[model samples]
Structures are given as structure tokens and as C-alpha cells.
Target: MWGREVHSHRVLITIRTKFMARDVHINSYLIVATCGGKAKREVSLEELRDHIHQYYIPLGRQFMVLFPEGGFLHKRREISQRFAEKNNLPKLEYVSLPRAGAMKVIMEEVGPHRDQAGTSKSDDRKDNNFNQNNVKILDTKSGDNIEWILDVTIAYPERVPLHLADVVCGFRPACTTHIHYRLYPSAEVPSDPEAMTTWLYDRFIEKDKMLEEFYRTGQFPPKGNTPLVTRPVRQDNVRYFILHLFFIASTFIQYKLWCAMWSCIW
Candidate 1:
């Protein structure tokens, strides 16, 4: 959706499931993690970083979404909570504890370096351009560094169908998917592994609270108090218009074909 809106490319970091890996089309733009494989060994952060550098960085992708929670299942959350307790980390309520190793690696690998003034050049550039046209533009492709890390939390108001068949068959109505996002300047992120880990954990704790508020009140917590700050949602109006035209043209052709066939049969 963002890719369409911004006219930029996207690459996904997904689990290396057999079904996904086998499809050549889907596998091309993905950095597939080997967590679900029979080996049960997870891919290292360095390896993931290398993969992104080699594939996605060159393509100039504007957004690379990473789910540090790993998995969304209740069992997975329980395991994560137990692990957090053992590690003396805060236990989250609505979200799983974020594994920060990958995030730290990503920040170090792609985050901007500080100059003599302890200020990031990337941040400076962004700030200089902020008031030019009332357009917020963060450059992520000037070189290797990513300017921002968008922390997004998604929630379903009602029960979400887990199965693909149910979704494809339209089992649910047009339900609203609540999304909250907060953009973290890459320069602001800690370089130290432990500090970065703590930082990631704190973010998840905030997400847990936001989810609690959402479920209780059916609305996200306000911007001032909430860590999940809202950004204006961008709609791809042009893309939708093109899709509408395509649908109408296809229906017209199908109708004409059906009428011709019926006439011949009569």
C-alpha cells in the first residue's frame, strides 16, 4: 500500500515456509528467515543484514517492515513472556517481547553515523527540508543508511479469520483494521546492543498499552500521551481509479461475450 502511494518498491522479510520459498515469484523480493524449517535454527542478524544490503538496498525500497515479535500466536506470546521473565525483562500484555538483536544490527548496518557535532547528517538534511513545502521527506536511499524506522501496531476490532480460505470467501464484513505508527529517527536509536534491546522492549510495552486502550475504548490513545503517534494515512487514489476502470472494462467484455453466446444458442 505504501509502495503504491509513494511509487516506491518494497521488499518483505518473511518466514521461509516451504510454500513461500517454493514460489519463485514470491521468494524473489523476500529475505526469508529459516526459523520454521526442520533444522529449527534461526538466521543470524548479520546474515539478514547482508541479505538486505545485497538485494533490497540496491532496489531502492522505501519501506522494509520487520516484525520483531517473531510470531503472533498466543503460545508464542506465552513463550516470549517466560523468556522475558527469565531475562529480567518487562512482560508485555498485548504484544510479545521484541527480540532486539536484529533491530540493533539493522540500525548499525543501515543507520546514519554521527559527525563531530554528535548530530546525524541525515537528520540535518531532513530538518532543513521540513518547511520547504510542508512535505515531510526522509531520505532513505541517499546511501546505505535508513532515515526512519516506522514502528507500526495493527489490531483487528473483532475476531480475525486466520485461514486464507475464510478471508478469500468473504467470511467477514468490511472490518476496520486499526493501525498506529510511530516513526523513530535512526539517529536517535542506541548503538549499544543492550541499550538497544531495552529500547525495543520499551516500545513493545507501549504497544501493549495501546492495544489495551484500543480494545477497551475502540479508539487509539491520543497523540500527546501515547507513544503510538498517528500520521495522516495516504491513499493511492490513482491506483484505485485505474483498478476501477479495469474492472468496468473486464465486466463489459464479459457481458458482450455472454450475450453473443446466448444469441448463437437461441
Candidate 2:
């Protein structure tokens, strides 16, 4: 679970147009885009890039999360497959084709490149010169590049809730949600558009396989081998104990008030 209190990083989520109305007030950092609608307006890559460079980057934000598959719908998956086939892209099983337009633009805009000081040596080596120049120029003041891609895969062993209401109303019982995190260095991500597209798909392919293994065994591959690491229980034990006492006292007071009301009514 992503708790804002634990991790202080600001979040920006991509949500469908239809679901946008449900919690309109909670749209401080959400990117709303229509899905399969006639008058759908896609989020512009230029706008997103500008926003990051101007706002997020200057503020020194470390992470930006993007769901390239858009939405996890079966129909969308079918459409993505058709598009991939037409473009001669690899067929993916668990994930849909990533919309490379924004990703490509973002990478070109923010991906790592040699700074002016580092580029000076490239003139000595003819072969290295071409490769150095190929890297896109960025106007970052700190000269730091987006170096890591944290690929997070979340899995619900039980059936996923159909709606947010199901979760709020506690319709679904306690289910095991497994999360696996992997960090890919900048060198691993290709800068070329076509290669980057394939790279994104390949990451998802691994996720698909991991999910398959999870469903089959109800445990991730590393579960048995790796020891579970968790936050110290003592950190919150005192807070929980105080809350438990408050709950008991409140219930007793409420019960007494209810009995007094019944007697008066009688």
C-alpha cells in the first residue's frame, strides 16, 4: 500500500474521464484523460513535459509515475494488440502496448546526456563524438539526469474489486496484495524510440511471467528465499494502544446513553 505519510513524495495519477466525476475535489495532481470516447481529449505530451520541467524538476522531485497502458481494460488490451500487430510490434500477454508518444518525448526531454565539461574529451575520440552528440541536450540547472526507473508490480491474489464502493463498504474480505519493486538504471533504457518501445514491453513481459507464477503458487519467487522486511512494530504500538482504549471508553458511554433513552421512552 502507498501511504502518503510514510513516503512524502507527491503523486500524480492518470484516471479515466468517467471516474473523474466521482472525486472531483481530489484532483490536485491527477491527469484526467478520456478513454474510448467520441469527444475524448488526450493529455498532450508537450504539456506534460513542460509541467515536469517547469514545476516538478525545479522542485527537485525524484519520481514520476506513468501508467503507459492507459487503463487496465480487456477491450483496450485487444485494441493495443491490433495496433502492435499492425506496427509489427511484439505481442504481449499480461500487458497492453504502451503509448510511446509521451514516453519518447519525455525521455528525449529529460534523459541523461553528457554535460559540457564531459563533452570536451569526446573530440579526442572520433567514434565517441558521434555517440555523445546523439544524446539529447537538457536545460537542467543541476545537470542531474533521470537515472532510475522503478518498475513496481502490484498483484491481488483474490479477485479485484469492481468499484471503489466495494472497497469503501468492505465488500471484499482481506486479501493478500503482493508488490515487487525493481530499479532499472538509465543505461538499461534505450534512448531510441523503437528500441525504447521494445524495452518497455519487455519489462511488462517479465511482470506477466511473475504474475503467472504468483497465481500458480500464491507466492512470489523470492518469498521463500528472501526474509520479510517490515517497519518496526514498536514504532506504532503506543499509538494503537491509546486508540484501543479510546474506542472502549466511547462504546461504554454510548451504551449508557442508549439505555437512558430507552428508559425515558418506556
Candidate 3:
């Protein structure tokens, strides 16, 4: 579980990802708000894809997203990064996009061969060879090779292609001998967490202002809704209840004053 503060606004978002039966779980919610509270709106997949393409993909980071088919998340980041490297396209961020709904997961390559049988091999490098960082010789009882893998879940909008999985797997051979640590979902791990957070914050809270500024500068209009923002707003019923209480109190006070006056006159 992780909490990230989006930039340009006062919204803190909590993120979590878990694995169950080969499926990854994602949960996210805002910790703080602005005004009128955030609504329970559907996360838009198209907008999410556009965000990754326009923002994250150019940064040269590895990311993944699940598909509607419900299979393994694809390794799209690795492929994109590899392509960028081959063609020398400055710096590109590698991210996955699903075909539908939101998703949350950060792909990281873990090292060290603990073996699926729960056998720890801290000294495997001095003892044996062949990829110890990625499960050596399969012990069979530790569940499938996929079970040993874990990921960090971040917020996402939908389904992505499966080919991205292969790309992520392609990067595992580079860790030092006998290293045990692996990458899990975390904003702290790749790029600038602060930058990402601030970008998201500005996207949500400053929609109208950003649009006007862009228009003034003659910039292209944003493709999706300008501000995908959320805020906590007070309810009208609560205000009405307060007024009703005041009215009742006023009536009671008037009745008491009348009783006092009648007693004095009597």
C-alpha cells in the first residue's frame, strides 16, 4: 500500500495492489478533497491511455496494465522502452494500457532465486550458476512460476494487451549475483513521484484555469475532460437540518417568554 500526493492541488490518493489466483487486485481512494467532495465517477480508459502516452511513456519507465480478458498484465513498457532505445527517441516512458476501466500496478524486475519451494539461497551465486535471480530448476511445490511474482498496484483506467508481459520478463538477467530484492508497485521507485503527483493534481483541480491559460496561449485543446478532479462538498440536507433546529428553538423561547408575562399579569 502507498499514498501519493498529486501536484498542483491538495488531494492525497491511497493505492494498493494484491495478487489472488493469478489475478491482480487494485484499490484507490482520495485522502483529502477541495470543495463539493469527489463523486463516485467511472475512471475513463481512453483518457488514461492518453495520459500515459502523452506523459509517462516519454520518461523511460517500466509499467503494466491488465486487460479485459483477465489474463496476466502485459509487458508493454519493456517493449516500448526497447523500441525507443533502438531508435534513439530521446527518453521514453514505458507504460501499459488496458482496453477498458482503470488499473493499478507498477512492474518491477525482482532478483535472487529463493526457489518456489520456500528454499532460500543467499549463497547460490558461489554454489550454482544459471539464472538464480529468476527461479532455478523449478521446485514444483511452490505453485506455478507465476505465483512467485508480485507487483505494486497503482491507479489505472482499463484493459491492455498481454504482449507487455513478455517485455517485462526480458529485463531480469541484469541484477548482481545473489541479489534478493525485487521491484514492487511504488511511485517512489520510478521517475519523480512528486512530479507525477503534482501533474495529477493540476489535471483535476485546475481544469478551468488550465484551459483558459492554454486558450490564451493558443495551445491545442485537451482531448479529454480538462479537469478530472475530485473534492469533498458539504451536503444541503445538513444545512437544512441546522435551520430547522434554530426555528424550533426560537418557538420554544417565545412560548417561555409568554408564560412569564402571563404569570406577572396574573
Candidate 4:
């Protein structure tokens, strides 16, 4: 099973079982499904996890296939590893298959039909650009932001659907609360890799043993996104780089002036 997406479905071929039943048991299973938003409809990663555990685990089936990109699947890897460590079950592994290889099989099995499929329209792109551009970030200790503005008219001449773009863009739901915010400028919109590191550190790591506790309980604490006040970090780096270059140019001018004065005296 790849996911609920009509196009990316799969059938289970075989069940491989490995049981280490100590005081605690570490059962495993593979899950597959499509990845998309809430309103579009279909099976969710959490639903798949529950389904696999309910149907297969008790029946002596372990090891589930999961879409590499699925959201809930992420917590599984972390939780399983923690369970294995605490109870000393065994190393847990999560495998990811290429989209074509695994996703194709799942879609073939379930045969789901998409309501609105295919490339997005120009108007859709324009709308996304407009929304992101006007998006306001509020409630931070520091005023730092990654500007996502665009010339909407030029960028999206006409309306278009954005299903494909959403997947490729790595957009995910985040905790948003309205609070006072300040603005910081950036040369380019900060990328996800950079942002995630900051988020993991400020939001996850900074918490007192949150990673360990979350792993043990299989629960994520409700931490407001206030901790992610590091947009200025990226912006500061960019600003510093620009300032350093300016300083170098100023130093060069001073050297030239000094040389000219010395040359005239000589």
C-alpha cells in the first residue's frame, strides 16, 4: 500500500515475520499510500499505521511498507527505535522505495480515482503566489522572515491547479498562532533544509529531554512555534556576508589613499 491517492496504490505481496517477544514485543510492518492534503480526500498515514497494526500484527504479520514521504510514518521510525532500546527488542528499520517502484504498485491495487488530477492551472499558481506573498509571520522574539513574494501577474499568467507542485514543494501543516511579529529581510527565501535544522533545534532539542520522552511515550508535546524565532539567524548571516564585502572594499580604498600620499611625498 502506497496511500489513499487513487493513482498511487499497491497490494501486499507477502508477509515476512520476525518476532522477538520479550517482556515487550517489537512488531514491524510495511505501509504504502498516497501523500496529499486533508480536503482532497483519501487514506492518511495514521490510518494506514492503525490498519496494519490491527489487521496484521495480531495475525503474526510484521514489517509494514510505508510511503517514505508520509507524515505519520516519520514518528514510527523514532518511536520504534525508542521502544526497541527501552525494552531491548532489536534494531527497527524503515525502508523507502522510489516513487515509480512502490507507489506504482499501490495505485494499481486500489485503483482510486482523483477528482481533479494533473498539472495546476495558471490561476492556481497565481493564487498560491499571492497568498504566500502576503503571508504574515507574527509572534516571535526576533523579527526575522523569509520573503516568499512574487510578481503574481508575471509568475502566473492564468489559473492552474497546484497538486503536483504541493507534493514537490514539501508543504506541510504547521502550528500557527496569532501573535505580534516583526519583519526581517532576506536576499532569497530560506530553504527547508536550513529551516528544519533551526526548527529541530529550537522546537525539539531545546525542550528538556523532549526527544527521549516523546520516543518513550510515543507522544509529541504541544510546543507553540514561538521557539522558531531564528529567521534572523539566516538573515543575519546574509547581511553579515554583504557587510564583510563592503568592509573589504573600504579597506582597499584606504590602502590606495595611503599609497598615493606616500608616492607624492617620495
Candidate 5:
């Protein structure tokens, strides 16, 4: 319901925990991709399509969070640098190169459904796939097509990012984080694979520069600091309590229902 970007605290949880049910209940869907290979890209695209058809179409979710870096910036930076060097591309320091195939899958499934009509735009490309998935998503009550791609840049103080464990365990003290936002219309994003890759790289390059400036000046855009990073850190105790209470109540209700049915059988 909230459209305009607001300064809000975030929750970070790792998937390795025994919280699979709660994780899947949310709209988050994970795609397993290889660090290097030709087949991994195709596999990731397939997984993305399946996830979109399952949850995105039914739930009518528009906003998508994609980490083009493939992994954490710290972990993948060296690999990205090596790949860039080998390919004679720009060597990024602050951010890793994002995957273009993922963008391709998203735009293809959530594109102009009526206009494309599965019609092939180019000989190299196959079907546009603008029929079933888009039709189902459009039919949902809360459903709407994707309109904007938000290029969010999150900068950690001193380039020190808090991990899932760090956030959950309070390993680090509360520190102000700076975030920058940019948006582009979906139409502005390239649909062709080659163009799309270039476009994504350009965005990340810009992001890298922003991060560099943020590290130097404690703010993005190389301008004076904004109140966006000056807000007081709010506590998440109330939210955690409510979430836990809901989980317990739901489990108890399910248990009672199961008991009632079993009593009749016995």
C-alpha cells in the first residue's frame, strides 16, 4: 500500500535457519545460480519464470528486488574484477556486475502483454511470452503491471555491511545507513539481451561511483549530507513480538483443528 519511499528499518534473516515455512510464506523466492557458466544463466531464467507464474502472477506483486551482484559485494568483488579484466570491461570497485539474464526474465514476463501478443520482435529471439503469465497477473484484484524499476543504492558506514547474523545478533551497534533512490520506466529498460546487459552494467557502474562518493563524503551524489541518513534508529521489539505471537497463535489453531478432526475419526 505504501508507494512513496520512506525511511524504515529493515529485517535481515538468513535462509539457512529453520524458518523455511515462514520464508516461503513471504513473496521472497530464491534462484540458485552458478558463479560461472553458460548454462547457469538459462537455469536462473527458468527458475525466475516458474517463481513469477507461481507467486508473482497469483499475488500480483510488482516490485522486484534483484541483486545484480549475484552475491555480497565483498565476496564477489574479486571475481567480478577478474571477469571484467578478462573481458576488457570496466573494473568496478564498489559494486559487482549484475546479471542481465535475470532482468530479461522479469521484463519478458511483465512486459506489455497486449501489444507483444507472443509476436517475435526479432529473428534471434523466440516467443515474447506475453499471454498466460501477464493475463493471470492482470486478472488479480490487487494486480498491476510493473511500471518502475527502482535502482536503490545502500551504503554502509565505512564500507562495513552488516550480515544477517550481525543484524540479528546485534553484533554491530545501531549506525545510520545512507540510501539513494533512482527510478526508470519499464519501457526505458532494454528488452533485447545484448542491450539489456549493457544497460544493467551502466546502472551498476553508476552505483559503484555513488558508493565511492558515499565512502568519501558520507553521502551519495558527492553533495552535502541529507536527513535521509540522520533519522533516529527505531526499535523493532514490537514488530518481533507481534510476529512471534502470530506464529504461535496460528500453530495452536491448526493443532486444535487437527485434534477435532481426529476425534471424529477415532
Candidate 6:
């Protein structure tokens, strides 16, 4: 399995997992769903950690999806702005400040061993032990560990975000949904909670700028201030690539069928 720490939805995650992950010659993967926020029962760190150990590591799931923003943009914007104001942090209008507790747990459990790695000595936040009375279960090995953190910023056509209901009910017409990706080595990520919080804040701030540009110009700017080195997209064997199109189609069909069955059962 290619370890990925990303923020993504299920159907797309399924496709990416099929493309990047396999176990014992099988192209299959599992998803673990966890919630954030207080309205829907504030999830305890211990419970969240247990879920990862209980489902993800044991089942050998490839992707651990996280919505570090904790809630939808509209729902959390005011709260985030207030917190930012109180903390003297930059007021981010486009992206919400990320909650770092869950991120911290996942990284420590599966990224690098605490014994091997120490908390970052950065001045962003005082060096602190956030995870206290920690009892870890995941066997952290070179073969089994998170290697990449994919920061995926999804931009819908016309800056309108779509919901699962829209996709399920066929209310919205098909349109191009642009996704910009910035991948970070998991090793490069700060291990400690405070440093990780600062890291997430920095990422969201960058996202805010990207999003503002996207909304204004109708296209995401090339990553950072650097010039884009343009190259033609590689086209694989036409016959082989045609087969992949069929495969992707089959996945969407399967997903629709599953949704239909689930709706019936419920």
C-alpha cells in the first residue's frame, strides 16, 4: 500500500487508491470515516486513536482521509475568524484554520516512531508533549508507514461547491472540477502537535491565497511564485488507456449501485 495522508472524498479516493495502492496483488482498499466538531459529539483523542488502530492499521487500509478544517466552510468561518482574531493570527477568509489533534495522532501512530523522532524545536509553539499516557498499537516499520501528505485543494466550476446529495440525485450537471495537488513528504512534517498545528495553519494560509486567485481569475495559479515548466502530457498506449476509461466508468456505476442499495436498505 502506498501510504497517503490526504483530504479527499470517497469516490475519488477509490479511484486514487486503485491507481496507487495494492495488497498481495489485489487492487482493493478500505476507508475509515471519523467526524470532527462538538455538535456531533466531540470525538475524544483516545477514541479517534482507537478507531485508527481498530480499523485502518488492522485492515491494512491505504488512505486515511482527513478534513482538518473540522467543519464546512460556511459553518465554521465566523468561529475560525474569531479564533484567529483572539490569537492574533492572519484572518483567513477562504480556508478554515485546521484542528491538529487528529492529525497529530495519525502522524505519531503511523508516520515515525516517537522514540526515533523528537518534537520539533521550532518557536511556532512551545515544545510540548500533547499526547500524554500514549499506548500505541500500530507496528511502525519501513514497509508500513505514511510516506506522503497530499494537500488537495478542490475547486469546482464557478466556485460552487457540490454536495454528496447533488451527485447522488443527479441534480447538478456534469462539469469540470479542478483539483490542485501539493504533496509533502511525511518525514518533512513536524511531529509534535504544536509544530503540526503551525504547519497546518501555514498550509491553509497558502490555500487561502490559491483559492482567492482561483475565484478571481477562474483558474488556480501555478504552484508558488515559480514559473511553470510546461511539458506535454504523456499519452500511454491508446488501447491500454482506453481500458482504463472503461475501468473508471465501471467504478462510478458500482458506486451508483451501492448508493441505490443503501437507500433501499435504509
Which candidate ranks first by lDDT, i.e. highest?
6
Candidates 2 and 5 compared by lDDT, better number: 5
The residue ranges of model 4 lying beyond 4 angstroms of the native Cα positions read: 1-29, 40-43, 70-266
Q: What is the C-alpha lDDT of each candidate?
A: 0.55, 0.52, 0.30, 0.31, 0.58, 0.59
TM-score, structure 1 vs. true: 0.61
Candidate 4 per-residue C-alpha lDDT over 1-266 given as tens digits, one digit per residue, 9 for 90 to 100 = 11111221122321111111111112353434344444321334334423432443223332334232233334444654675477554433421111122222222211121111222222254345332555422111121111211110001111112234453543733222111122222222123334422332222122223333434554433446745332211235588679888999999999999999999999
For residue 35, model 1's alpha carbon misses the true position, in angstroms, by: 3.9
Model 4 misses residue 95 by how many Å? 14
Per-candidate clashes come to 0, 0, 34, 34, 1, 0
User: Per-prediction TM-score, please?
Assistant: 0.61, 0.59, 0.16, 0.17, 0.67, 0.64
Please provide, for model 1 over 1-266, each residue's C-alpha lDDT reduced to its tens digit, 9 standing for 90 to 100. Answer: 11323444332231211011110111344332223332332345435645555555445555555656554445456887899899897777677775555565556545564232242223444345332454422234433355666676777755242346654555755555667766666766677667777877787778778778888888778768646445555667699789889999999999999999999999
RMSD of each: 11.1, 12.6, 24.1, 26.5, 8.0, 10.5
Better of 5 and 6 by TM-score: 5
Query: Candidate 4, residue 253: CA error in Å?
Result: 89
Question: Candidate 3 — which residues are off by over 4 angstroms?
Answer: 1-192, 204-243, 246-266
Residue-level lDDT for 62 in candidate 3? 28
lDDT-wise, the better of 1 and 4 is 1
Best candidate according to TM-score: 5
Consecutive 10-residue window with the lowest summed lDDT within model 3: 29-38
Poorest 10 consecutive residues by lDDT, candidate 2: 17-26
Worst 10 residues of 4 by lDDT: 148-157
Model 2 C-alpha lDDT per residue in residues 185-253, reported as the tens digit of each score: 655677666788888777766776766776788755554567644332223658867987999899999
Error of 1 at 138 (Å): 16
Q: Can you write out model 5's per-residue Cα lDDT over 141-171, one digit (the tens) per residue?
A: 2224456666767777777766778866678
Candidate 6 per-residue C-alpha lDDT over 1-266 given as tens digits, one digit per residue, 9 for 90 to 100: 23443332212120111011111111234332224445432345445555555556555666666656645677667888999999999898777776666567667666654446543222122112232244233444534567677787776776667777885566997676666777777777777677878988888888888888988997778865966443334435698669878998999999999999999999
Model 3, 57-134: lDDT tens per residue? 232222233332222223344553565467553222212221112222111111112231232222344235433445
Order of models, best TM-score first: 5, 6, 1, 2, 4, 3
